[model samples]
Target: MVLTGWASMLAVFAVEFLSLLYLGTLQDEAVMGAVGFGSMTQFTITSVCIGVTVGGAALVSRALGAGNLLRARTLAGASLVLMAGAALGAAAVFLAAIAPFTAAIGLEPDVRAHLLSYVLITTPFAVVMGIGMMLSNLLRASGRGRQSMWVLLAGTATVAVLDPIVIFVLDAGMQGIAWAGGVGRLATVALGGWLVFGKHRLVDWPGRRALLADLAAIGKIALPAALTALATPAAVIFTVSTYATFGPSVMAGATVVDRVLQLAYSLYFVLPGAIGPILGQNLGAGQWDRVKQTVRLTSRWALLYGLGVATLLAVFAPRVADLFQVAGPGRDLIIFFCRYGSFAWALNSLFFVAIAVFNNLGYAAYSTMIGWLRATLGTLPFVWLGAHYGGAVGVLLGQTLGFALFSVIAIAVCSRVLRSPPTTDATARVA
Candidate 1:
């Protein structure tokens, strides 16, 4: 888990450089708002991947925990099939949605055209990322944390190495910028494929009936989770609308802040991800008490980690802001929003760990709701407020408020539900 943090710490170097873009320096708030929408083009894809990947992870983790190693491996084969489907969908979506989707962010004509072109060219990479993410999550749940991190390591390293060459030297412009990301993600896919297909060979030789069961299991859990993940990109759509009302700087700041927030989230990813397999296997083994302990310990760790990062942000808010962008007049507002908004989101460690536990314990419904709250319900109103009065700052407040509410409600729910996880696989199998 700590190594995962170290890996994430290293990731900042890559993320900082790749995130910034000029977009012709905020002519109107609408152009600024376009930053969020345009930026989400990738995330809308990634969020879809997350939603889908969670299904794969949940199924694979359960199989791994159940001591059905062969079954788990077979399910991985099924995942390859699903990822192929995702690739086809991504291509079509990009073709159909690129212009209109980019336009909806409401950027100025020139700015929207620039943004749309970037999205159109880069859309193919969405599926490449989908494959990598699915494999990584499968590995994570099977207790191969380092292996999963390694894939990201390769991708981030590739992106870091390629950014300047692609954008400036090759004169790819936004496409070049997008290419750096796409190429890096392609590297991740390659490495992940090696692990899943070449070395492990889990992604070969599938049984159609069993594969259908695997897909069904994944769909049951992932459907709601996917919807939950959609909330984030959807919220981005809403938040971008608000930032659009302000100016590009606000949207720029939000984009920058999201990078930092993602870096922060990598910490959450490390432990819960590591613990998910442990808890799943334990649940599969019927070791309910140990499953309980894993959740508690991971949550404690998450809290400690969140506090540590919050302290660092508080102490070095200005410097942190600078890493994302220049931090001008709106610097104060953006910094406040990002730093505090992250703090609130950070506290979700308890809930997040709890969600992982629920997934393993066969309460996928419990796990799914939090994603919905954060992405859909919580973020929506904040964007509305940010649009009406607060601007970017209002959205930050909305984000923080959403997490705060989740934290409170989750604690209450976790307290009651943690007492008992479902005892049998048959009972737990909602699918």
Candidate 2:
């Protein structure tokens, strides 16, 4: 499960990083910045849908954990219906808000055009992505993680192959990249749908009332989890907008840094993500000791993993800068960020693992509170201060300080939750 989940997450980072790397190779800073802005903004915009998926995953995991196959199947089907609806709504919102989104982010006209082009092309197909997200989470939660892995591999491979063809061979440029991504996600939706329907089969829709009950169950988890998921990206949008004030160079540079950091963080997320289903199942089964043990052991492993990744980032900072082909102020900022800002990710790993634990245990509201505090109180204030006084380095420092402080808080919260008696309600009826 760990290996498969890790590999899939890596592929996701690769798809984003390599696509941007191709843009960077074009020597068009505006294009790179546009891609970055579009990507980050996409994440922020789809956060609500992400919350729904997470909520569904939690319910599915708990249902599977408690051996309620019928409930699991019903929840999966309804959640898919909800996610598809949300995707269409999100698509419209993304299109309608494009002008305001770009202008608020301080993008230049050329960059804004590229960003608008990318979002306009890809936003509608976000339905495919929403379906894939829900299916992947459900697959993982249901113990068919390898199937989930292959689905991601297929999708990412499609994107990897198509991106260059569309951008370079077809001479489509940014729009081509967007279309390529949409095509890739379509493949994901196909394969993931097959896995869910053909291989596992969502139990069977019991009846309207039962299905609605399952959706209400999912909503309880999804709404808070979605709000929790929003905090980080919302903070990021604010910080990115703040960085944009320094001009496109800084924004572009920060984009490169963010991707690199995400690559590192993906590695960090492997265990936490793997742990989710395990904890969910165990919690559902009322295996409190196993849950507690898993948390402690994973927490230790996470700390070690964080430190190792940070060391590598510090050592390879220059090499990474060259690989990305970044130059001028952008290059310098990437290097500085790699050397200094990367270690904060070590702290971030702990926070993520803690979040996974909280979410899986039906403590999503607590998890949401933690995320909100970290993003708003822990991050924005510090980032605003740094941007005002110090520029890029200061901004990075401020973000790092936020991570450092919140890591402690997150750990404490997880510890408190772990110390409690395990819930006997494996179905998460209360949540």
**Candidate 2's residue-wise lDDT over 212-245, tens digit each?**
7777887887778778878878888777777767
How many clashes does the backbone of model 1 have?
7
TM agreement with the true structure for every prediction: 0.87, 0.95
lDDT of each: 0.65, 0.79
The most accurate candidate by TM-score is 2
Model 1 pairs in collision: 29-244, 29-246, 29-247, 32-248, 33-244, 65-281, 231-375
RMSD vs true structure, all candidates: 3.3, 1.9
> Which lDDT tens digits does candidate 1 get at residues 199-246?
866655567888787777777766665665565566666666565555
